[model samples]
Target: MFTTRPGRPPSWRRALVTGGAGFLGSHLCTRLLDAGTEVDCLDDLTTGRPGNVEHLAARPGFRFLHLDITDPCAPDAVTGPYDLVLHLAGPGAPADCRRRPLKSLDAAGLGTRTALGLADRDGARFLLVSSAEACDGRGDDGPPRSPWDDGHGDTADAPDPIGPLHTYAEAARFAEALVTAHAGARASNAGIVRLYPSYGPRMRTDDGRTLSTLIHHALAGAPLTVPGDGSRPLSVCYADDTAEGILLVAASRSVRPVDIGADPEPTVAEVARAVLGLTGSHAPLEFTDAPERRSGGPFDGRPDGRGPDTGFARELYGWVPKVSWREGLARTVTAVSGCPGPAPATTAGHGTGRWLP
Candidate 1:
C-alpha cells in the first residue's frame, strides 16, 4: 500500500479511472488500489481487454464498469462522489487512430467532456491524460518549455490547421483546450498531463506504436519494421512511472500540463536494436517507405536541460521517472513473452472475455 512520504500528505480516498482496462490505465488502477484508494474503473473495452484487469476484480475496493464515457448514459450509470477522477479514455495507437478516426476524435472530445462533467458534479479533482501529440504542430523546433510556456517576447507562430497525419494530435489539442476552459470556469479542480510514448506490459501487439511493435516482431521472429529513416527520437516512460507521474500531478495543486517521460531519448532504430538484444531475436530490421507527412523528424531528447522541461513537476511534486529504458524494456519483454493465452471466460468472479458493444 502507498504510504505518506515525509512531506506529502494523503490526498485521494476514492478515485475513478476512465479507460482503466487498457495498458497504462490498468497500471494506474493498480497503483491507486495499492495506495488504499477505492477505485471504480470505467472502460468500453473497444481497445482494452478484460484480461488486463482480471487480477483486480477480486480486490475489495476495486470495481470495473464496462461502459464508454462518451455514451449518453455513462454519467448516470456510474454515479460517484470520487475524490479524484482520471480521464484516460481515448485511442492513442497510430493505426487505431487512422482506422477509426471518428472514434479517436470522439474519445478525446466527447469523452473528455463527459469526464469533466462528472468531476465537476462530484467536486472531484480531475486529471486529463493528454498526449505528447497535443504539442505537435506548434513548431518544427520542439514543444514549449512547459504547457504554460508561451515563448517569452517571441511572437507565437500561427496554429496549424488539423490534417490527416495530425488526427490524434489535433484531438488531444482540442481536449486540452476544453480542459483549460473548464478549469477557467472553476468547474472543478483539474490538471492536464501530456504523456510521451509510454510502453510496458499489456501493450497490444497490434497497437501500431513502435516499441510494442518492435517487441512483438522480435517475439515472433519477424522483421522489425522501421518507417522512413528511423531517426525520429522518442522518450518513452514505463507504464508504472507514467502512472506515478500522473498521480503526482493529481495529488498536487498545480493544474498546468507537465510532461511525463524519461530521457536519453533513443531513435527508432536504436529501440529496435535494444528489443532485439534483449530478446536475443535475430529479426532483420526492415525500413519501410512512409508518407512524407508521417515521417517525423529528430527531436531534442535531453532529460532536464533541453526540450520540454519537467522541472515544474520536480519542484512541485518531487517526481522523476525511476526506471531506465533499458531496464523497463527488459521487464516488458518478459511480461509480453510470458503473457498467457486468452484468459478463461470467467476469473476472480468477473468476466474476462471481451465486453460487448
Candidate 2:
C-alpha cells in the first residue's frame, strides 16, 4: 500500500540485515531481494535458526554470515560499501531476555554500536528494529493510547534513567539513546522502527510469545492458555507488513522513531478463540497464572497501551498494514500445519546445510 518516493532512486542496492535468520529478519531478506538489492544476512544463531533463511540460500544476491555483532572485529568479516544496514540482532522475546539479561543488554548496547559503525563507515542508511517495549511502561487499565499520544510522543518521554537499568525495556531504551546520540553527532543517516506484536510463518514454536504459543497449542489440540483476566488488548501486525514498514523507514530520510504495527487491537481471549476457530481445534480456552505480567511482556500477550499511531508512516511513506487479523491468522495456521519437521536446514538449491563462519 506504499510507493517509493518519486524522482529519488532507491538508495540501497547492497544491504546488510543483522538478524537475518530470525522470523522477521528472514522476511526482510526476502523483501530486499525481491527489490533487486544484494543482501548479506548476519546472525550469530544465538536465538536465530539457520532454517529460517534456508529458502533464501539459492538467491545469487543473498549470503549468510554467522557472526556475533558484539565481537570486537565482527564488522571486519563483512565486505561492504553497503547502502543500508538494518540492526535487528537483539533478543526480543521476554523469556529469552529473562534467561540471559546480560546478553540482551550487550546485544542492544554493543550490537547497536557495531551496526552504527558499519553504517557510518559505508555511508549507508541505518535502521534499528526497536521494540514497543522501548515506550514508557503503562498499566493494563484505561483506554489504550497511541505511541504519539500526549505522554508517549518520543524517546525523551521514556521513563527516567536514574533508576536501575535492567530488563529488556531498559535495554531497548538505552539502545534508542545510543542511536539518537549517533544521529545527533551526524554519524549516520538513521531511523528507528518500534515494532508491536508481529506474527506469521516460520515463528519459532518455543519462542514463548502469546500468538505463537496459542498457535502451537491449537495445532497440538492442547488448551489455549490466557494469563490474568485475559482482558489485555493486543495489536499484532503480520510479518510481511512489519517487514514492509522497516523497508519504508530505510528508504526514508526521517530520523525520528516511527511506530509500525496494526490497530483496532484485539483482546487476548479474542485472539485465542480466533486461533481455535481457524485451526478447527476443539480445545477449550484455559486461564492460568502468568510467571510475570509486564507491559509488552512476551507472555503478557497485549499492548501496554493503545495501538501504534501509524500516521507518521502513512504520511512519510504512504504505508499501512494491509493484512486483516482473520486472514493473517488463517495464513499462519496453514503454514504451521504444513511444516512436517524442524525448519528445513537447506532449501533445495539455495545453499548447503553448512553455514558460513
The lDDT values for all models are 0.73, 0.75
Model 1 C-alpha lDDT versus the unseen true structure: 0.73
lDDT, candidate 2, 211-319, per-residue tens? 8889889989899988767777777899998888888887887888887888846778889999989889999989877544343335432234556767777887777
Model 2 pairs in collision: 57-350, 58-350, 144-306, 145-306
Cα error, candidate 2, residue 251 (Å): 0.6
- Report residue 328 deviation for candidate 2 (angstroms): 0.5
Q: Candidate 1, residues 1-357: lDDT per residue as tens digits?
A: 233562243446789999898888999899888878989898877777788998998898888887777877788777777888999887766666776788888988999999999988888888988776445222236544433245674434323445555665567778888898989987469888877777788876666566877887898999998877887666778888888888888876567787777764778888899999989999899998743433432222321223345666677777788888888888898888866433222111223223332
**Cα RMSD for candidates in order:** 5.2, 5.6
Score candidate 2 by lDDT: 0.75
Model 1 poorest 10 in a row by lDDT: 343-352
Give me candidate 1's TM-score against the actual structure: 0.83
Q: Which stretches of candidate 2 lie over 4 Å from their true place?
A: 1-3, 6-11, 136-165, 288-292, 295-303, 338-357
